[model samples]
Target: MRMNPTFIVMMKCSEEAGVQNPVFQRLYICLGALKKGWKEGCRRILGLDGCFIKGFHTGQLLTAIGVDPNNQMYLVAYALVESECKDTWC
Candidate 1:
């Protein structure tokens, strides 16, 4: 088993829709502790899943998970994307 690597990289992007409207384009959040834990204590396989969101602003909840030695799911990263497009995946 490997431990998750530590990191501290976060990104947020947006664009102005109108004179007073700002639309969220993309967001990425990853923690160093989570990464280190994953690398040190988690298995090699990584699971990815998401679902369509329903509300005022529609989007998807994307997540990355890994299995640990005890076969437990470990959360690695998460994001809220407008859609499951190729660009978003990358």
Candidate 2:
């Protein structure tokens, strides 16, 4: 955040029934550089997708992508959430 004032980072946590403290539920990140680059050089069209994450951390990985003027893929943003559901997407 210090490096990029426009950067955005968010974290969500929830308390379990018997947990003593809040547990991490989700995280979202969008770098300032990436966002600026997308807005200035990428096409208006955007594509969103998600996939399940395996191993130690079990969740979903969501991504937003766009196309550049050169017709190449340009990653806009991404997030890690507990699940791929309507609520999570929002």
Model-by-model lDDT, in order?
Answer: 0.80, 0.90
Q: Give the residue spans of candidate 2 off by over 4 A.
A: none
What is candidate 1's local distance difference test score?
0.80
- Candidate 1 regions off by >4 Å? 1-12
Cα lDDT tens digits, model 1, 10-65, are 54566656656665766777777887789988998999999889989898888899
lDDT of 2 by residue, 1-90 (tens): 677899998888997899899988999999889999999988898999889999998999999998999999899899999998787756
> Highest TM-score: which candidate?
2
TM-score of 2: 0.86
Give the count of colliding residue pairs in each prediction. 18, 0
